[model samples]
Target: MFNNLGNLADMMRNAGKIRETVEKATESLGQLQVEGTAGGGVVTAKANGRLELLAVRIDPKLLADGDAELLEDLVTAAVNQALTKAREAAAQSLSSLAGGFPIPGLSTLLGPGGGGGA
Candidate 1:
């Protein structure tokens, strides 16, 4: 009871600092980039830690092949892989901001196959 109250007070006192840190982390996320490739690197997708798809590159040979279905599949695979990496990176950034203090449902919220993604 008394200890809990003291802890709450401490948290309240640090709330502004926490908010600032989160803002900085979020801003940095846009600059953090990750890449994912498929079909032996024939298709590559890039995403930022904010989980936004940045760019995609397909090999010239793949385009010249004129296999639309295969190209679509490879593109999908590449995008999914990139988004997965972005999610992991974003989660890592937030986890570090938490300083090892467990946040309820954080892993599930940001982890691979959780929810948010491209």
Candidate 2:
């Protein structure tokens, strides 16, 4: 009978490669962009899978005088919206990369598809 040890070794090596690929893909998602808007699109925000803010946009009309409070609120709302989208994007991207298996320490880190423990 043919031994299965060689096949087992190959499978293990392949699994390692898969893990490496998952890590790389996770990194790539952070480099990718996910955008969100708030206050009827008066404010916009963007973030990556790592939940790092990349940019924000405010409508010129929202820059009028005596609108400091409104502006602040809009900014906050926009950022929160962006964060929500960012979380979704991260989760989807990481899930795609993971292919099904839960990532190691994923619950501890703030990466996508992982919990928000981080």
Candidate 3:
């Protein structure tokens, strides 16, 4: 029974370590930048690995043209693409840390596809 208790203690320690590693990884992920473009570069979107949209760029010509509908569509497309890239980067970063152990719920969080992209 003492041996079992020791094993449980070890498991708890390892779990704490894993949690710390994951926390650091998640924090760093927000610093990562990703860009996505649409309309053949007419519009570009930037985001962090946390999937937060940061900024957007529009070609001077597009704005000059004054096509509100087209501009809106392009902006939406760019933002969506940027978000996808951010999610992918965040997932990859997280998966690298979680891959070391067979932690319950971690697999599901990372997903079965294993690419770790949303």
Best by lDDT: 1
- Runs of candidate 2 with Cα error greater than 4 angstroms are 1-15, 111-118
What are the lDDT figures for the candidates, one per model? 0.81, 0.74, 0.77
Per-residue accuracy of model 2 over 4-111 as CA lDDT, tens digit each: 667656657798787788678778867878778888998999988778889999988888655898889988988877777777777666766665455566654554
Candidate with better lDDT, 2 vs 3: 3
TM-score of each model, paired residue for residue: 0.80, 0.74, 0.76
Query: Worst ten-residue run, lDDT, model 3?
Result: 109-118
Clashes of 3: 0
In model 3, what are the clashing residue pairs, if there are any?
A: none
What local lDDT does model 1 show for residue 82? 93
Identify the candidate with maximal TM-score: 1
lDDT of 3 by residue, 7-96 (tens): 666768798787888778768877999999999999999999766789999999999999999999999999988877776776777766
Pairs clashing within candidate 2: 90-112, 91-113
Write out the backbone clash pairs for model 1.
Answer: none
Instruction: Write candidate 1's Cα lDDT for 79-103 as tens digits.
Output: 9999888887887777777665444
User: Model 3 RMSD to the real structure?
Assistant: 5.3
Model 1, residue 6: what's the lDDT? 72
TM-score of 1: 0.80
